[model samples]
Target: MSTPELQWFKSSYSSSNEPGDCVEVATTPTAVHIRDSKTPRTAQLKITPSAWARFLTTLPT
Candidate 1:
């Protein structure tokens, strides 16, 4: 089986003034994908949903 193409979107927190300094994300049933918005065709990072949640908790709000 093959996975479908990911639907990437820029981060909500991305500054409109700094378009090149942004990140994009896509979510699948098993993993979350992250990549630089300026370089979508480059390599991306993948992590489990649970791991993503843990990472979010570590961020300062």
Candidate 2:
């Protein structure tokens, strides 16, 4: 019916010096939710756990 409420937290990678440029994450057993901290009301993306893993692997170290 409806999605369960998730506890959101800001990413540590978001530099404290740049509070305006940040992202928030909310995780569930089935998917991960991502949203912009600056404009959260605009849109959000949900990705499967596997897809999230693949995306993470592509990021620079």
**Which candidate comes out best when scored by lDDT?**
1
Error of 2 at 41 (Å): 1.8
lDDT of predicted model 1: 0.91
lDDT of 1 at 10: 86
Output the TM-score of candidate 1: 0.87
Candidate 2's error at 29, in angstroms? 0.2
Instruction: Give per-residue CA lDDT, model 1, range 1-61, as digits (tens).
Output: 9878899888688889998998888999999999998888899999999999999999999
Off by over 4 Å in 1: none
Lowest lDDT 10-residue stretch of candidate 2 = 3-12
What does candidate 2's lDDT look like per residue over 1-61, in tens digits? 9967888889778798988798898889999999998998779999999898998899999
**What alpha-carbon RMSD in Å does predicted model 2 have with respect to the real structure?**
1.6
